[model samples]
Structures are given as C-alpha cells and as structure tokens.
Target: MKEIWNLAISPQVLPLTLLLVPVALYWLLNLLGTLDLDFLDVDIDADGPDGGDSSGGHWFHGALRFVNATDVPLMFVLTVLVILLWACTMIGNVWFDASQSGLTGGLIMGVSLVASVVMTRYVVAPLKPFFRMLRADDEKHPPVVGRTGLVRTAWVDERTGQVEIEMQGAPLLLNAKVATGTLSLPKNTEVIVIAHDADTGIYIVRSISDSIPPQSL
Candidate 1:
C-alpha cells in the first residue's frame, strides 16, 4: 500500500492525479444538486462543417473524432479520461519502477498516458448505450403541445420567455412566447401551450388554464 501510495504521489503520476481532483469535485457537486449537466450537452459536432468533419485536414479535429462519436456528454468523457489516465499512470509507475527511475520515469509516464488514451477510445464504444441510458432522463425530448407550463422568466412575451413543464421523465425547460396580442406572463404564471411553430421552434402560449368546466348539477 505504501509503495503504491508513493508511486501515485510521485512527480510522474502526481500530474495526472491532480487533474482528476477537480473532476471528482464536479461529480460530487453534481450529485449534491449544486451543478447542472446542461452545458455539457452542447453538440460540438454542430459547430463545425459536416457535423465535426475531421477529414478536412485539421489534425486536432481529426484526433478528437472519437470524442464526438462517443455520444456521451463531453464532461462525462473528460471525467472518465482523467480517471483512466491517473490509474494507468499509477500502474505504469509500479510496474516499471526500476526503468521508470530518475529522468527515465518521464518517458514511461508518457507511455502510460498514451495507453490511457488508447484504452479510452476502445472503452467509449461499449459505453455509448450506458451513457444514453444514464442521460435518458436529462435529454431534451420533444415538447408536448397543449400541455400547461409555468412561466419561469420575469416576463413572457413575443420576444422572450421561458417555461417549465412537468414531464413524465423530468422537468422540461422551454422557450415560450405569448400568443399575439396577449398580455405578458409573469414568472410562475400557469399557461397552456396553444401552438408550436416547428420552423421557429417556439411554443405559443396563453395564460388561460386548461381546467375542465364544472358539470351542471
């Protein structure tokens, strides 16, 4: 245990180990509800031509092709890579202790880093299904038209607004706009979606609740 501890804290392994600390902290914070994974869900492929096309001769983009193919959230991939690197570095330090002594240890450490990357590439393929399942609840599913939602922004009008609707799997956040000529909806105002403009991708809403009328007694 002591030997492993020494190897983990050594200069070669310490750098990788240090990089993992913040990743651990982020996961802890996420579990505690202090962080949201929405930012990590951005589709990097969309920003580039042909949806992250690497065949265009950019080495950096080419190297990262596996990351986009993983389909898991970017942050999750980063976290896994950091962890794998730290573990692999520790293992290499132990196995090649004699060869990894003094200045030569740096070379062995580099090999461990490369090994970690290779392992991550192979590992992410099988993990796609698992990650999809893990993020299933958080994924942005199609908005249900005619469903009632509560305005979350200060005011919802023709130009700007946000709403929160209770979904079967999770709360769905959506950009909304009051139907033309309607008064702006204040925060927490219950509104029903009247129409969805697929081209514009915005929900047209009204403040009137969808309550059923009482039957005549």
Candidate 2:
C-alpha cells in the first residue's frame, strides 16, 4: 500500500492527477442536487396562426450555442478516465516495479479509450433515434389533441374536467376544456384542436367549423 501510494504521487502520475478537478466538481454538485445548470433554453410557440415562433426575434429561433462546449460532458468523461488510468498505473507500478509500469499503463489506457469511443458511438448514438421517435409521437398525439371521444364530465368555468378519447385504438383519459370565447360550449360538444400549450400540456380546441355561407348574395 505504501509503494502504491508513493507511485500515485510520483512525477509520472502528475498528468492524470491533474484531471480530478472537474470530476470532483461534478460528483459534488450531484451530491448537493444542484447539477441542472442549463446554458440553453428550449421553447415551443403556439400563439401564431401557423403555430410557429411568435417572438420574431433571431435569438428566439437560434440553436443553443454553448459558451464553453468542452466544459461539459467531454471534460467530465476525460476527468473520470484520467483518475481511472492513474489508479491502474499506480497499482501496476507498485506490483510490477516502475520498469513494467509504462507498458501496463499504455495497454490499459488504450483499452479504456477504445471502450469509451465504442460506447459513445454505438450505444448512445443508436438510442437517440428511439428517443426522437418517442418525442415525435408525444407531440403528434398529445393527451388531448388528435384524439376523438366524448366528454365524460362537464367543464365549468375552467374547472377540472375529464374526457374519454380514443387513441391508437385504445381508450385514454384526458383533460377536456372549452375554448375561451363569448360563449361557453357545453359538455359532449364535438371539437377540433387548434393549438397546444407545451408548458401546460393543454390542448386548445374550437368547435369543428363546417359552414357554407351565401357568397356575396
């Protein structure tokens, strides 16, 4: 144990030892439950006629640009790798002497690098499509939109109400509502969705417009 400790604190292990800063910070923040530090904001606009960006500002439509992209996941991963490699090298140096330490450290580092690359490329990248698909489905058929059913309970003055909607050939419970207008539509009224509020996860609806008024009579 004394030899291993000495080896870990030696000049050969200086580079690896220097990498524990961000790793320690990450774990410390996680333990304190304050790790959600978002440098970007994602918002969906629903007020416009086309349900597009309502802000009309370039900043609102632009993609997230990180101030320091390398300060995030990459730094965290490298920090962990450095710490792991340092420990492995220390053990190798103590058990097999400094002569064999270099070779063993190189082998272990190479294997770890390859494993990290493989996991990132194959495992994480492939799961991205599945996550995208789930998001798309959720957006398309949000609990109250793109569904047809009867109102099971009455919606009185924005109070809570329930709707039984048929979704994907299955009945689903959904929150129901009446559009804010001059008049309030009653229960069991057939309606078509006009917009969706992402923050509230609410679907704004209007009575299906089916009319052919006399043209320039």
Candidate 3:
C-alpha cells in the first residue's frame, strides 16, 4: 500500500494525477450543490476546421469522414485512444524495460495534454449556442392546457399557423389551430388554448370573448 501510494505521487504519475484533480473536484462540488459543472462544455475537436475537417487536405478529410461515419464524437474517440496508449505504456513498463516504459508514458502524457486543450477550445465552445437554443425551446413550449394567445398568422383548413403566447416571463411563438368544427381564426384574433394536440404537436384554440382584454382578458 505504501509503495502504491508513493508511486501515485511520483513524478511519473504526476500528469495523470493532475488531470484527475479537476474531475474529482467537479464531482465533489456537484454533490455539495455548491457548483454545477454539468453545463460546462468540453469539446475534443476544437482545432478542426469550422466544418470539422482537421485540415484542408486529403488526410484530414478522410479522417473526418471516418469519424462522422462512426456516429461518435471526435473527443470520445480521442479519449479512448489516449486511454489505450496509456494502458500500453503501463503494460510495457511492467513487462518490458523501465526506460521504454518511461518514454512511452511521457509520449502518452504529451499527446493527452494537446488533445485536451484543443478539444476544450474548439468543440466545447461551439456547442454552447446549440445548448442555449434547446433551452429556449423548452422554456417557450410548456405543457399547459389553458393559456391564451392571439393568432399571429392566418390558419388554413389544412395548414399550421403560428400564435404568440406569453408564459414564464416571455412571449413564445407556438403552433396553434382553431378548435375542431370551428372556423379559421384570423390574425390578431384573441384565442384561448383549449387543449394540446399531441399528434400534430399543436394547441387547439378558440376565439375568446370580446369583453376580455388580450393581455389579461
């Protein structure tokens, strides 16, 4: 046990230890509810082109094509490769010469550092916009049966139309339709959301009484 502890703290294992500290800290902070790292984005393909090509060359193009075909994130692939390389170094250290093991470990550490930086900068940063968009959509579309809105556009008998409804401190553009057997509501007509149609993913609406104001009526 002492030997293992000493080895864990040794210079040879320093890089791995450093890399693990942040992961451990993130988990600890999450458990305490003091910090949430779930939203912290990390990407492994940051150095690639805007379109995700590694370089404007055949080799990069081919590599990206293969990565895309596998339907896996580039960071995940890089992570597995780093793990395998490190494992090889460990095994080589145990079964082969000491000098060879140290060299292999150093090489693996260098590669892992570079990959980590590139991914953090490129892949993770670019995904923030997409995450924000998803969050916005979720907030805009809540499952409420009794809400009110005005038809923002005309609805045809067989077509979808948009409505503007306010909910949760914001106005959302949503798909809406007139109640079954009712006539199409014109734009700017006040409507009550009667029910949500799951099949068509729209809300059924009816003309509200003229006495009610659009906002609070």
Give the number of the best model, judged by TM-score. 1
User: How much lDDT does candidate 3 score?
Assistant: 0.52
Please give the RMSD of candidate 2 to the true structure.
15.8
For model 1, the superposed segments whose C-alpha errors exceed 4 Å read: 43-57, 67-70, 133-217
- What would the per-residue lDDT of candidate 1 be over residues 9-35, giving only the tens digit for each residue? 777777777787898899999899998
Candidates ranked, most accurate by TM-score first: 1, 3, 2
Best by lDDT: 1
Model 3, 1-217: lDDT tens digits are: 6854544455666556455566566557767998754331222121234333233433442454343311233444444444444444344344443443567656655665555444444444444455445434554456656778877653312234557777787776665666567776666777777777654455777777743677864
Which ten residues in a row are the worst by lDDT in model 1? 44-53
Error of 1 at 8 (Å): 1.4
Candidate 3 or 1, higher lDDT: 1
Off by over 4 Å in 2: 33-80, 95-217
How much does candidate 2 score in TM-score?
0.32
Tens-digit lDDT string for candidate 2 (1-217): 7865566566555555666666788778977989863321122221234433243422321211111111123333344445555666555555555564566656655655555444433333333344334434554443456545554433312423345566676665444455565243445656554455554444555455322245695
Error of 3 at 40 (Å): 9.2
